[model samples]
Target chain A: MTVLEFDRITKIYNVRGAGQMKALDEVSFTLESGRTLGLVGQSGSGKSTIAKILTQLETPTTGRVLLDGEPIPRHGKALRSYRQQLRMVFQDPFASLNPYHSIRYHIERPLQLDRVVPADQVDAEVRRLLERVRLDADSVIDRRPHELSGGQRQRVAIARALASRPKLLVADEPVSMLDVSIRLGVLNLLADLQREEGLGVLYITHDLATARHFSDEIMVLNQGRVVERGPADEVILNPQDPYTRELRAASPDPEKHFATAARDQGGAR
Target chain B: MSDALLTVRDFSVVYDVDPPVAAVKDVTLELRRGEILGLAGESGCGKTTLAYGVQRLLKAPAVITSGSVVFHDASGADIDVNSLDAEQMRRFRWDKVSMVFQGAMNALNPVAPIGRQLEDVFEVHRPAMSRAKRRAEVAELLEIVKVGAARARSFPHELSGGMRQRVMIAMALALRPQLMVMDEPTTALDVLVQREILRQISQLRHEFGFSVIFITHDLPLLLEISDRIAIMREGEIVELDTAERIWTDPQDGYTKTLLSSFPRLTGERGVVVR
Candidate 1:
């Protein structure tokens, strides 16, 4: 069953001088539990607009967003409860986490607000969340965000996101800020958690490579429009759209291109 | 590429905290006259400190305890960067070597036009040049980086991120320094823009025979652009070899882990086994 459905959602931002900027032009897609939907797009492609609409951070210019066959409420307690089931992981883990608070505080705040578990069980649940994200609760629980590495901080961010027991996660450019060496670890952790928890994930990113590996299905966004949509492998490996082809060509693969360049130069010498 | 442009020996930088932390330790490397030397490491691995130390750009508390940075000019003069006085270092900084810092695209002054910023580089170094001559040079530099003459009048926020980064590159190449030290130059840009910038850098390097000390955590990008790669772990250089050797047969365990951490598109997806 589809957990969240963005039904013909369109977002328009009316600027003073710029006039109306159509951020999302009638974008529509549905995400199911135990499945991942990758929204692949570059900057200003309305990827974040969709994420904002899903979390009800912004009201759609037109159309509707349905959750479990019911249209999402605009205000009041319905919106509050709807947000509990939907959590977002941002691009900058450093900024997302409060530097003043401990890792436990960040994770427990969500659990306390949502009342996901009993008062006494909150600590144990936090520990479980930490372990699930491959972080040692015993070592990192008491430490603030400043003390942790970039990778560790991201893991903590993930743990905090999972504290509310979100059914649908909207992670927008989550790993783009991370270093190359540790990006896979976080991606692998996300993929693993999605499978284990049977949660629907809206993985929004500009990168085609990680999206192909993590997402079950893919949607390519360009200038606030869905240019292409299909299974992840089909969209990535055998892309039909010209924009998708350009994205594929832009991806840096040193082994295929750089390694051979070195070989050719070495042979000539 | 036969002659060494810059040679660093036994360089170490220590931050004077309570216990004193050594950020860089006994790092020795050489950059040929026109070769690109890639420095690959994690965030706190001291790549930036090493680059700063080589040019005597380190400030107080972050002391370069012991090091020797020798720059060999085209006329074959061995100039010790460490021995240069404050005034001499000021003159030597951009004339001999220039740096494109991390997030340098945003480092452009928001209020001033990009043309004036490009002109400032030449104004400081070549004070004798006529205003008309400097204007012509500034326009030429902007065009060289592919920003075009029209972008000169535009503000920093008006241009795109890639164009701003191109302006930074144009300014860095303003003086035509022998060595260019870039720290994660294209990290902020998107994939397509990043590809174009890398291509532009490669093209610029061929056009202008300047040695580059390129530092980035992305090993594959380094392998693609750099002639040689240096892998730093903790505060030390664990391995330094040709790009081909480093890619094919990494000697150090840390190097192997660093390379394996990056996921690839061609290979088995998510196969970067910990």
Candidate 2:
């Protein structure tokens, strides 16, 4: 079983005039295969910083991340090999996808680079990946990113991420840009794929409700510090941290909001 | 005064593209005074098109094909919105109806102090007001939105995202318009900030007694604050009702689908919302 451990990752940024700014403070967590960990916080909470550090975009000021108990390689083939095992899914599908590249090309490059399949089987692998994401491979293969809707584009992104056959997937705000109606379908597909592949998934989003719904565990970050972490239901239903409670309270849950509103109106009358 | 502050009758808008497409089709709705009317739909559903058509804000290829939008002026006049000329429309716009667009915070001038930008509203519309009076009006407006009178001197970039959004709301309320059209006003903000903005809007509406047209794809958000909601699908309004009714007993299949789209905080992991 594959295990990804993020141990005490702290990131400090040197601002122009602001001196040292702590973007992340001693944040630590772990994810095992077949489990989903939801990282949630407001903007500037350093949730994205964790994703960046994991992807090697930014090095931690202190602490380190280990995959299978091995430090991530700094450069060359080892770094490339390390990257091959962990892939990223960005937030905006429209921007993340290349406008000039065909959907087939987007899915094929990762497979070709990672050499997941033989050169002859690359086309078939692309088809399989597209089909896995529930897209019609025959129809969407030649189309550009703009040709597909936002939901379809995001699905293509997921397929591309899976093309590498990574053990851990870091999805940063996957469906935040999508229309609310189609977000469920995409999320359900991701959940299904996660279970089927036994992939350790890091679902990062600011949306508390969805985090609670999809994640096995929820971690709350506040201004670059881990404020709360626990089982999803426990954290959401009876949050220990005041920040988590405020987030839960602020989230627009119709059932809770309406029920409370009705009681308050009744009491007022 | 009539309860209906604004009535849109048989309104339609079409994009003058190759083989022309009808973006909004025969949409009829009324905004009651002091009520928050929500227009909800997915992208390309024509809710935005209908709103733009009502305000004659569509430019170029987008044209209003048919119907009239009438405003029930508090001065006991039924003003035909489409008939107003350029100057009259300008006067009619900020003076009677204002808009807070999606990502409107970015619309502020970066070089100018936010206070100066707010004062420009009075400078242009209330042309006879002195400069000092305009500044004070802007300070008062800023305070009303809780951006603080001191923030007037600060540039747009100086304020946080939520504060910048509040500044936009202050600008919209500068003229004290009777109707405010907010198209996805708080969609860009975080959950906590979004709730704060919504609460501020609700409170302001209570004090000012002005109607609001809030548009977004988020049905749960509308269900939280909107008094009445119009569910649009494929350029047509399929359902219109109170938020409580829409939440409890949605009539249209599309509306039901939209409501169920949100993943609930408590329920089966893969399926169903609360």
Candidate 3:
């Protein structure tokens, strides 16, 4: 079933002298439960606008966001409940986490506030959340966010997101700030969690390489429009849009790209 | 293979803390004239420390414990960078060697227009130049980075992040130094912007024939751009090899792991590369 659907969503921003700016123009997509939809775009491509509208941090000028076949409520109890069902992970893990709080505090607070588990069972749920994200619950439980590595801190952030048992997760460049060596471990962890929990996810990133690896379906955003959308491999390997081709060219995989270019030059010779 | 433009020998830097942490340890490397030498490492691996140590840019608690940095000028004279007098060092910095510092995009004076900021470089280095000459040079430099001369009058806030970075690159190239030391220049930029900046740097290097010490944690990017790459780990140079050799047959276990860390779009998906 489709957990989240964006139906002709359009967002217009009014500048003092510049008139109306259509940040997202009739963007339509559906994210099924237990699936990942990757939004690939460069800066100022309005990728974050979609995230904001879904999270209800910003309102769309036109159209609607449907959760489980129902239009998302705008205010009061319904909006609060909708937020509990949807969670977000930001780009910089360091900025999102509280340095003063312990790991247990970060995770347990969410569980308690959301009442995801019974009061008596909150501790067990916190432990499970930590361990589920592949962090050592015992050793990591007492440490502060600053004490952990970039990767570990990110896992803690993921754990906090999972505490509410969110149905749809909007991870915005979730692992962009992490070291390359530990990036895959986090991606793999996310992939594994998506499999086991059957959660729908909107994975937003500037990196097509990671997007191709992680997402089931990919949508290429150019100047706030869906320029291309298809299965991950098809979009990446056989991209139809010129912007997608430019992105593929700009991706930092030098060996394969250079080798192909060299071969092409040699063949022409 | 070409003549060494700069040579660092037995360099070490130690922070004067309680335990006195050695941020850079007994390291040695060389930059060939007109070659792009890459320094690759994770954060706190002392790659930045090494770059700062070579140019005596380290401040406060960080002290150069040992080493010699010799710069071979075009006139075949060996000048020790370590023992240069204060006045000589000041002139030597932007004239002989300039550094594009990390976050240099935001390093421009917030209150000043880009034109005046560009002219400030000439004001300090080439003090004899008239106002007209400085304006012309600034315009030419802006053109080199493709920012156009109109942007010279605009504040840093007027330019986009990529444009700001291009302005920084233009400012760094204002004096046309023999060597440019860039520390994590494009780390904060998105992939496309980073690619464009790297391409411009490559083109500018080709046009001017100045050597570059490009430092970054992204090994793949380094492999793509550099003639030689030095891998640093825990303040030590673990492996130094040609970019081709480093990519094809890396000797160190750490280098191999670092290379595998980045996900490849074309290769086997969702598997640990090692």
Candidate topping lDDT:
2
Candidate 1 residue lDDT tens string, B1-274: 2389998999999999989999999988888889999998988899988988899888889998887999998767889998899889899998889999899877999999999999999899999999999999989998899999888899999999999999999988989999899999988887889999999998999999998999998787788888999999878999999887888888999999987876666657646221
Q: What TM-score goes with each of the models? A: 0.95, 0.97, 0.96
Clashes of 3: 0
Model 3, span A1-269: residue lDDT tens:
54788999999999889898989999999988888999999988999999999999999999989988899998988887899888998899989999999999999997887788899998899889989998889999999988999999999999999888888899999988888778889988888888888889899999898899899999999888999999988999889999999999888786685576558788621
Scoring model 3 with DockQ, what do you get?
A: 0.54
Query: Clashing residue pairs, candidate 3?
Result: none
Clashing pairs in 2: none
RMSD in order of candidates: 2.2, 1.8, 2.1
Tell me each candidate's i-RMS in Å. 2.8, 3.1, 3.0
Which predicted model would earn the best TM-score? Answer: 2
- The predicted structure with the larger lDDT, 1 or 3, is 3
Model 1, A1-269: lDDT tens digits are 54788899889999889899999898888998889999998878888888888888899989999999999988888887899888899999889999899999999998998899999999999999999999988999999999998889999988888998889888998898897778987888888888888889999988787888888899999999999999988998889999988888788676777556757788632
CAPRI tier for the interface of model 1 = medium
Q: Per-prediction count of colliding residue pairs?
A: 0, 0, 0
Tens-digit per-residue lDDT, B1-274, candidate 2: 8999999989999999999999999988888989999999999999998888899999979989998999999888999999999999999997999999888768889999999889888988999999989988988998999989988889998899899999999999999999999999998898989989999999999999999999999887899899999999989999999999998889999998888788776545656221
> For candidate 3, what is the DockQ-based docking class?
medium
- lDDT score of model 3? 0.90
Chain A, candidate 1, TM-score of 0.94
